[model samples]
Target chain A: MSGAAEQAPVLQVRDLQAHFRTHYFGVNREVRAVDGVSFDVNRNEIYGLAGESSSGKTTLIKTIAGLLKPPLEMVGGSARFSFLPDWDAVGRAPPEVVRAIRWRHLSYIMQGSMNVLNPLRRIKHSFRDFAWRHLGGSKAEFDLRAAAHLERVKLDPSVLAAYPHELSGGMRQRVTIALATICKPEFIIADEPTTALDVVVQKDVLGMIRTIQQEMGSSVLFITHDMGVHAALTDRLGIMYAGRLVEDGETPEIFARPLHPYTRHLIGSLPRIGDTEQREGLEGTPPNLATPPPGCRFHPRCPLAMSVCTTTVPAMIETLSGHRVACHAVNPGMAA
Target chain B: MSALLDLDRVSKSFSRGGLFSTRRVAAVKEVSFALEADKPEIFTVIGESGSGKSTLARMILGIHTPSSGQVRLGGRDVTTYDRRAFMAEVQPIFQNPFEAFNPLKQLDRYLFMTAERFGGASGKTAAEEQADVALRQVGLSLAEIRGRFPHELSGGQLQRVAIARALVAKPRLIIADEPVSMVDASLRMSIVNLFGRLRDELGLSIVYITHDLATAYYISDRLIIMQKGVVVEQGPARAVLSAPTHPYSRQLRDAVLTPDSAGAFRAIHSRQAVATPGVSS
Candidate 1:
């Protein structure tokens, strides 16, 4: 893990910012969804990005995947992937670059599997459409490659003949996984892949993700709002809030000793099956990104908020072993 | 203590397919449970897809009539209640926060509608006040969310708004279907904690439905484990979860991922290697 961490990251995001700037009836508003966020996803590692909706986690992943559509635009920062290094150099990369990189070197397992698969088209056609071009071989070779990918994810090859609607939700997701992985991408961005799944099936899907990630040696940017899923699958975790990375550390360390008040509250609020702790809800709703709080965005909801917190944005500081936090209460330098 | 809501051998079946090939899909079969009115508590219904937990929730809410048996709300048959009265007594918070409210409409409109309909708030001002109070209960202010669209607010904020809307009616029961499933991990806890608070402070009974058991055990006082519409087990939350008697319930419990057992999650990955038959089909 340390060796991979030290190496040039497979996906290096530096101060990446994607904002939703809208003009409605002569009024202009900018939502700072992913504001000055930086992270590195190394090869063969599962980097868990945990944040609530509106935390900008989704925007961050979307920006990384080159799937950004306006009114959500890349305001600033660079998302540099090892495979797509030159793609970002020009304002618009060539179609061949995009076509070659997609699924071949970069893949995404989305929240809704239906988003990728055509409802009318059979699963085999979808596979062929996605992987056939990239495989660059005879139809039989592509078919064999697709079957091998499905087999790795523990999906039956028979699903290829069925339509997406004919298959169950879990099966469709597995097919999506198989679709995304058939080309053996170096980086995989999974955004809430199992959020819609049942508890039993969620377990199955997550297990597949872990197994495939390990076996394929692909770096995964696994994003979910469920800390439990993050704890289970991710080796390292980063907590995002108000479009910024608030904390980043080992999964176990963050779970055991969460530094940021927001992270602390988030971890404390989790309902363990056996342990029944009296959990308190965070005091206020997340700030509207169009006009976020004056200083620290989370200050309105942080129980330990001080005068400084309302005035100055706290820097994410490494307070303990690989644990970084962006909060005035936790990091002493920010305290006034 | 008599049950506030009771389902006696209740079942719901839907016929699918063409006229020539008729298929009877048993969404809920022989499901029986009771929610004590006197002892108001959050009673969770746990199941996977096709577990029939949601179908049962809809029946309790009077949104759907049971094909057989009885679903009594406060000793009165649910199907017999008038729409207004049933809605006043039981409100719902749907699974998808984005789809719950009309995209064109402001979020506050739902709150005012509930307030006017259920709270008997005579005028616009009174309804606004009622809506404000309900929002406050869910840790939100009406001023902040008054003109906001569903897309403007985060999933957590939207779900809280949904819950607050449910509270505006001051219903005896709130049927929440996967309320926090879409909300982010950090935001999910806050919503789950709110359910606990509502039960304690407002004395409101909640029919919390989800495939997630960790939150179920955290807030639920008594829970029923359901599988393909069958009640596998029903008892006190702690007792049943800690020592589940039924094999299905045990399987569901074991599938739960806790922070402590992060390393152990891999073991349960292969437990369900065989794909189970679809109950709906």
Candidate 2:
């Protein structure tokens, strides 16, 4: 693990900012969805991005994958991947290069299986559509490779003949995973891939993800709102609040001793089976990113908010070894 | 004491397929449970997708009629109750808060309308007053929600408003089908905690339906574990969760990911690998 840490990161995102510039009847609004976020996915590491809806997690991953469109613009900063060094910022890369890099070098497994797999088309056709151009093989060879990939994810080859609706939700998700991993991409972006699955099926699907990642020796940027899932799957976890990463560290460290107030509240709030003790919910809702609270984005809901928290954005500082937190109250300029 | 809500061997079946090739699918099969009238408690139905938990919730709420047996509320057949009276005594909180209300309409309209139609509020002033009271129960004010569209409020706030709308009718029983599932994690506890408060303070019975075992364990007083339209286990929530007797129930419990159980994925992987062989690591 120590040796792996010394190796260069597979994906490095530095001071990234992506904003949604919307115009409703000439009324201008700018929602800073991803504001100065930075992180790195180490080689062969499963880095979890934990946040709720509107926390800019999805937007950040989209920016990283170079999936930006009209209103959602990459305003500043960089998303640098190890494989695509020719492009300084992948989000700003040329369309042809993005198309060339996608599937072969980078792939994504979305939350909803229906989003990836067409409802009308058979599962095999969907696989062919995504992986065919990258695989560069005859139809027969593609079929053989697809079957082998499905087998790896524990799905039978017979599923290729059936429509997406015919299979169970869990089975469809496994097929989606198989489609994403057919190329053995260097960096895989899985956005809440298992959130829609049941507990029993979720365990199996997670196992499949772990197995595939290990076999491919790929880095994964796993995004989900569920802390338990993060705890189970991720090597390192980053907590996103509003549009900023409030805390990030090794999963066990974040779970054991969370430094940021928001991180502490988030980890403390999860309800466990044997523990019947009442857990306190955070006081306020997540700030509206359009006009987010001035200083620290979480100060309004932070229990330890001081006057300084309202006016200045807290800088990400290291509290413990490998644990980085952005909080004025906790990281009072004292290095651990 | 008499039962507040009772399901007596109730079952629901749906017919699907094209003409001349219809197939009958049993969605819920012979599910029986009861909540006592005097003792309001959270009765949770835990199941995965296609486990008939949602079907059972729909049957209890009278959205779908049972093909066999009966669902009785306060010793009265659910099907027999008039729409107004039925809605007054029973309300529903759906899974998706975004879908619960119309995006084009104001959020508080549902609350005021429920108060006027089912809460016995005669005039606009009375309806607004009732709406305000219901919203207060969920820790919101009409002032905050009034005239605001559904898109304006956060998911947690929208769900709370949905609960408030349910409260406006002053329902004896509320059938919540995965109410907190869509809400953010930090706010999920508040909504779950609200259920306990509703049971204690408002004396309202809730039929909480979810696939999540953790929240079910946290809030439910009594629960039934369902699998493929059959009730696999039923008992006090704590007892059933702590030491599940059924094989499926134990599997579900063990699959639940908790913070304390770090590295649980590897354990689950190996165990399932033993059950179904030949999948490469």
Candidate 3:
């Protein structure tokens, strides 16, 4: 993390537009899932991406990770990794090139930990399958290294012998974290890793992630809809709405003074143990990506929406130091 | 003279495998709680996965009979009550609204059926009237949902429709098992707020089963924290949540991440968890 490119971000995503293009009969529909999303994961920092379902958070990550299939196409722009300077996006890169960096330089801690592991195979096989090739080690050496990795996260070494189903949900999550961090990738994509686990286990898993991330000094693009987890785990937080980044800044600052209306609502509406105050849920559903509203996608539901908001898309402006918000009402004069 | 719902040390054990090697798994073990007929309040059952929270909800709903003890609803055993009569008194709001309502079937059918069967609506017009009333209770109109499939409505709207279906029955108690789990974070409050309204306005006692502690504190009047089919803590929601005595309860409380808990990454990175014996082990 601290070398010649120490100042440079590990991952730079710029004006990335990935759409779900579907064609049936005479109709051609393009659902802009990641429309002009731009962000940077700086070296050794946790950048949290927050958004509701269909806000394009998943699409944005998958695009960045180059996990694209049919109907899901990287329409335009680039998500350039520092290691792969020649290539724009992993999606656009050749398979051999893409395959070379996976698990060694880049990895993912997926949401469903159990699904990530083979149901029929022992847990050790997952290690062998995902990390074995990257490490190029003997079976016994890989097993030993995997066991040590598991132990680093405070899991018993015995867990390696058990099947995915045999281990508890929390343990599997820990294993996933260990697996993702084993190679010490410069940047890790953690997609809602703690959302399914119970509060107690969730905290433990989060702590394990923090410890490992700090130890490895790797950048993480942690994505979750839970604001609480964002507040706890991330260094910087970005709020997404309808395939666009609405606001992003330091986690504490965002929590202290949320600039975007949606961010404000998200932070405010969270039910805490001590607070019994009435919190209102936003009206209107998340817009259909296939046919989003004109101008600002959030205008239809934004409580502070004006005529300008309905007509013009808001640019991401630095309202406060390092705090950028995309809202017409927030940045009235700064239309440029 | 009668409690709205009572579970006198009720336990449920599901047998596994065949006769060769039978194993009995106690999903709910010796759990006891009661909601009074005279009072209407949200009584929450909080637990994580495999904690038997769902199993307990089933027993209360009369879907699963307890292996031991009694589940008396309004001074009578839930198993003794006829299915139709029982459903009229207690309605369930499942976790996922998409799965709760048949996607192929129109949303109005559920509301209409509930109206005719449990709501005591005689004619087509009467059923329509009942459905409309229930829909209004959840802040939606029958006209908007009329002839619309489950897919047509959003997750929040479909969940509201499910609630409306529950309301159509005019049930004395509503057993909502993780009702807002599938709904979006932004829309979760609307469904949760609707529960508060149901308690205050409609005077319906709700047994809200969820693992989320924050929401439990927000809506529940009383709550019992469960761990592996055992109640670890039980008291008024505010008192218990604010200062949980049990180790498991304390751990659950401490684990909750909130906006206020945001701290400097370097300074307040990760705290060494205070070890709780017999639990974390």
Docking class of 2: acceptable
RMSD of 2: 3.7
User: Which tens-of-lDDT digit does each residue in A1-336 have in candidate 3?
Assistant: 123133567789988999999899989999999888888887767899999988999999999999999899998889999878889999888999999889888899999998899999888888888998888778999899999999998988898989999888899998899889888787899999988898888888887888787776677899999998898889889999999999998888999999889999999899988888988999989899889998888999999999988778888898898789989889995552
Query: What TM-score goes with each of the models?
Result: 0.90, 0.96, 0.96
Residue-level lDDT tens digits of model 1 in B1-281: 77888989999999999999999999999988888898889998888988888899888888788999999988999889888988888999999898888999998888888888887888899999999999999888999998999888878889999999988888999999989887766567789988988999999999999887887887889999898889989999888998999999988887777677665544433322212211110
Clashing residue pairs found in predicted model 3: none
Cα lDDT computed for each candidate against the true fold: 0.82, 0.89, 0.88
lDDT sort, best first = 2, 3, 1
Question: Which segments of model 1 are wrong by more than 4 Å?
Answer: A23-28, A87-92, A334-336, B106-161, B164-170, B184-190, B265-281
Shift in Å, residue A126, candidate 2: 1.5
**What overall lDDT, based on C-alpha atoms, would model 1 receive against the true structure?**
0.82
Candidate with better TM-score, 1 vs 3: 3
lDDT of 2 by residue, A246-310 (tens): 89998988999998888888888888899899887777798899999998999888889888888
* Candidate whose DockQ is highest: 2
Q: Please tell me which predicted candidate would have the highest TM-score against the true structure.
A: 2
Evaluate model 3 with DockQ and give the value. 0.42
List, residue by residue over B183-225, the lDDT tens digit for candidate 2.
Answer: 9888988999999999999999999999889889998999999
